[model samples]
Target: MKEVKIESVFQVYEGILELPEDLQELMQKAIEARQKAYAPYSKFYVGVALLLDNNEVVLGSNQENASYPSGLCAERTAIYYAGAQYPKAKILKMAITAASQLRTTLEPIPPCGACRQSISEYEIRQKSPIEMYFMGERGKVVRSYSLSNLLPLIFDKSQL
Candidate 1:
């Protein structure tokens, strides 16, 4: 049998200051949203800000429910809101920031599997890549050029 390989490539930035002006602004917005996150149980707050083709900046903060799986992630929260508010607009970029109240998180924190899949749907629907930038409280940031970079073998509508 022949062996195959799959690679997920991304750039590492020392800090938010190294990013472009637009990205810096986007990240700042995400950080602000993160502060508003309701994550009393986990104490791990996450925020996401989306930049759409319509020039609108949409923000989302993780909302948790004591009822376990009832809560939604910040990524989906922002994306779904964007989809409903501007169905015709395409998503251009997404900035994500996560922090833990218990400690100082300094490393990049990638999106959970569910978030990746949810983002892949939008990427496919828009027929374009959704640039993603993710990081923790204040430190190194990771930049994925596309959602495919994060979720290589995405389960899309084509499968169903």
Candidate 2:
């Protein structure tokens, strides 16, 4: 029997100031999008912003529903919008931020498994890596990983 280990690779930036100009702008847009989040249930507002190759930025905020599952994450919302509006464009980067109702969640919020898969699909479709940046309400950038980092061993369309 052979034992194999999988490693996750990522880079951590000191803060938003260290990000590229366009990425910093996208991150700021994600923060601003938080205000529009409809999170009556979780009280956890999440915002996502995506940068497309055509120099277009798309923003999305979490929308909650009473039924729970019907609600969608900001990442998926923004990504889906990009797919519908800019099908041919490649996704370059994504920034995400989250806040809690009680207090600012100081911990960096990670995406749910489902959202990771959704983002992975787009990355595969575009045949390009999508850089993901995430931070908490206030802290150093918690995590920054490429699309390949989050969805290693992904089943691409070629699998079918």
Which candidate's lDDT is highest? 1
Clashing pairs in 1: none
**Cα TM-score per model:** 0.98, 0.92
lDDT of 1 by residue, 1-160 (tens): 9988999999999999999998999999999999999998899999999999999999999999999688999999999999999999999999999999899999999899999999999999999999999999999989999999989989999999
The sequence of per-residue lDDT tens digits that candidate 2 reaches over residues 15-110 is 889877877888899999987999998889999999899999999999999998899999999999999999999988889999998897776676
TM-score of 2: 0.92
What value of lDDT does candidate 1 attain over all alpha carbons?
Answer: 0.95
How many backbone collisions does model 1 have? 0
Q: What C-alpha lDDT do the candidate models reach, one value each?
A: 0.95, 0.85
> Positional deviation of 58 in candidate 1, in angstroms?
0.4
